[model samples]
Target: MKSVDATEFRVGGSDGWTVTTSFNYNQWAEKNRFQVGDSLLFDYDSGKDSVYQVNKEDYDKCHTEKPIETYKDGHTSIKLDETGTLYFISGNCGNCRKNEKMVVQVMACRGSCNSAASLGYLSCLGVVGAFVASLLL
Candidate 1:
């Protein structure tokens, strides 16, 4: 299980998941630097609001119908397992049309796995494996 104490972000902060204001989300994400090991927690009323993971094009278009993934449990946790551009929007059409969306640039973890390795990216487990292999040799 990923540690809740670690790099996790509560979407919308003190106001929870509801769009207090577009500026709230904008300011919340401004100072945050997301990494592969981090996660996002969305807390809201599922009936009126939903979270949609989408692509840039879809996000820009506010196309909430077809999403890369959908979460509507009110409290959702999405782990960042890869590094790239990640886009999320409100699945509720009106809320989305009003521009309730977020774009995050997920970056690779910088500490243990910072390298141009053959397989490209490695998780913390890979770092451990490398350490173990060194010990064996």
Candidate 2:
């Protein structure tokens, strides 16, 4: 996957994953923007699941790590199903400073199993045809 440094706050992957890290919740939310079909993974040292999202207007009442999926080793996964901007902030005040956010893009597989199977069948047919011609000669 191709990766580009999206400054200290964010990192972008060619596959379609964006990673972001920030100490301040408000700062991170303001800078990063999310879109539909995008996936987000958060990396934290301690507070993996401790993340929250709030609407732009009412930032105060919006505090919960509910939407965010936490990982054991400072990692979180979020899939952006809806086409809208998503905002997040570190719940841990202390760890926030050191936390670095990362974005990972999930790329679709280039070929499906059906395609592979068809190619294999074609190849076997060619071999069989060649063998039969040689025997007849």
TM-score of every model versus the real structure: 0.76, 0.35
TM-score of 1: 0.76
Model 1 bad stretches (over 4 Å): 1-5, 113-132, 135-137
lDDT of 1 by residue, 60-128 (tens): 898976799999999999988888988899998778777678888888774644333422433344877
Choose the strongest candidate by TM-score: 1
Cα-based RMSD of the predictions, in order? Answer: 5.6, 11.8
> What lDDT does model 1 reach?
0.77
State the lDDT at 2 in candidate 1: 18
Model 1, residue 40: displacement in angstroms?
0.3
Off by over 4 Å in 2: 1-34, 47-49, 57-73, 93-137
Question: What C-alpha lDDT do the candidate models reach, one value each?
Answer: 0.77, 0.40
Task: Give per-residue CA lDDT, model 2, range 1-137, as digits (tens).
Answer: 12222222232332111224523334444465544334565544453335544343322334333434334444546665544444444454333334322222233323222233444555576877745644553
